[model samples]
Target: MTDPGLQPERTHLAWRRTALTFTVVAILAARHAADHPAALVLIAVAWLAFCGTAYTRGRTTTRPLPHLTPVVTVCSVLALAVAAVLVR
Candidate 1:
């Protein structure tokens, strides 16, 4: 069986990886919206919000994960997807 002590470390790493992924995607989306200033601003704001939640969760490893985190993440991704499709 896996060592229980390492589980929190692994979870923390996973959240960091997720935050990195969000950052990369947000950058790409912002680039895609370069021609539209409003869209760029919106994307930046969303990115900031997502990174905030991710890092917050990372720092509070002792607490149970917030129910809203996944919902927010999925919604952000969906918004990005829709924006991409509409842009194209």
Candidate 2:
């Protein structure tokens, strides 16, 4: 079997990629938010935190720390909700 750290490393990299995607979408939302800025703010907050969390998860060796995926998934859903609200 692979070293235990290997799975976390892969999960961390996935989170990083998720963070990148969120950042790009956040920027796009900001550019278009002149009429609806709230969504952009939410997106910015979620994405920035996501970036930080992913970075931390990648570096830390401690077990029992919160998993990055669920946190990210929650934030992503929130972001999506914000977008949906903005669209309506």
| Candidate with the greatest TM-score versus the true structure | 1
State the weakest 10-residue window (summed lDDT) of model 2. 57-66
For each candidate, what is the lDDT?
Answer: 0.77, 0.69
User: What's each prediction's TM-score?
Assistant: 0.78, 0.62
Candidate 2, 1-88: lDDT as tens digits: 3356577677667767876887787677676765666776676677677777767766564544566657776876688578657956
| Candidate 1 lDDT, 1-88, residue by residue in tens | 3345877787778888988998998888888888876667667767877888888777667786669788778777766776676566
Clashing residue pairs found in predicted model 1: none
What's model 2's lDDT at 58? Answer: 62
Can you tell me which runs of candidate 2 are displaced by over 4 Å? 1-12, 61-64, 67-69
